[model samples]
Target: MRDVKACRVCRSPLPRAGRGRPPAYCSRACQAKAYRRRKNPPVPTPAASRRPGRRRQIAEALWRIAAERGLDAASMREIAAEARVSLRVVQYHFDGKHELLLAALAMLNADNERRARARMATVDVDDPRELLRAILDEFLPVDEQRLLALRVFAAYFARSLVDPELAAVFLHDGQPLEELVATVLTDFGGIPDPRREADLLVSGITGLGMDVVHGRRTLAEVRATIAYHLDRLGGTGKVPGAEAPGTAVV
Candidate 1:
């Protein structure tokens, strides 16, 4: 007697086949249905299937290499070697050095937004001050990853200023940051002019970040400076510092 079991697709009994994995469907109809289901699931619009995580890993490796060795010295071959991927793979994903650099910048922007949002969610204070403090505190050069990301961003920003082509992409990507800041301030602090307030806050934070990255200001001093600004902005008095709302800290 052959072992038999219900097919996963149509719940029909399946006969044992030659030595191999058990059949998932009982018959051609069930198999076709299963295939159709996999081919066209009822899920909402799926995200682009590009290997962004893989690309991000490669980009980070490239950044590390560029930092240790000057960007001029770091070639695609070297980047591929560092990332443990083939040169063709890198080229297939990016056109050239400029594209790779842009990709790296995109990765940095995305990672920063993710980290900032995560930190903000953990802050217990509902007042704009605490939220501002939370966002700025995440900017401090307290860790290697943050420091590296800031350095890359500053470098790209400088390069974009001189390169008109790069400037367009840089500005396009940066618009979101300003918008996000404005939204947060408007919602939390009842900021009258969200856009202007966002611009001002982003400018202040950027300048402060540059100083901190260059070791011109201590972490405590930076935090205090930002806190002072937050106090002036009505963050401190609005809501008492308490546990963050219900959300994963990061």
Candidate 2:
């Protein structure tokens, strides 16, 4: 008599086949699980211990790659090597490169938000000038960390132009950066059209930040330009001899 065979994955009894090749797993679910195990295995020892931090590790690796070598170089194998993990580990954490890209962008947005909040925490919220400065400062590549972040952001922004998935990360319905600046302007209590001014300021600062990142302008020059704009917006209690409202300042 033929001996009963067991499922490879669940070890459950396998139904006898009439005259075909023997079955491996008890069910399709088990079969898929077995395949996944063979494909990804398990993260080993110390790395496995820090499973929670792996996502951030992988995202940060992508950032470094994008910042230094450009985003196109950030393949799964390269990211895994950069993060010092096996490629399977990255695959285990993220479904695919596109999913990973979205995750990394989300992580970056959250990190920047946290940094902005931390910077603002030191200043009194009632002080619109200081609060506004804090918010804009987060955008500038004034230090090494911020510099790396801005560089990575530039890479993501470029890719977002063609990729709808990446573009979705930037497009959102809510109080955008401009609205936040506009709200602060409203508190400052002088600008006629806070929203329009906020829009221009935000756009101008973004352009200036990119300029600094590309070495076209020094940090000092960008900071001076920001200070000049803030002064016009009544940063220091409304500057004397400032251009009149509705007058184009050349």
lDDT (10s digit) by residue, model 2, range 132-246? 8878888899888888889998898888888886787666566588989999989987677899888888888888998998899998998888887788778333554656554
The 10 consecutive residues of candidate 2 with the worst lDDT sum are: 43-52
> lDDT by residue for model 1 over 181-218, one digit each (tens)?
77667765544577886787778788887798888987
Minimal lDDT window, size 10, model 1: 241-250
Give the number of the best model, judged by lDDT: 2
CA lDDT of each candidate? 0.70, 0.82
Error of 2 at 240 (Å): 5.5
Query: Per-candidate RMSD vs. true structure?
Result: 14.5, 7.5
What's the lDDT of the predicted structure labeled candidate 1? Answer: 0.70
Report the Cα lDDT for candidate 2: 0.82
Per-residue lDDT for 159 in model 2? Answer: 85
Per-candidate TM-scores read 0.62, 0.77
Clashes of each: 3, 0
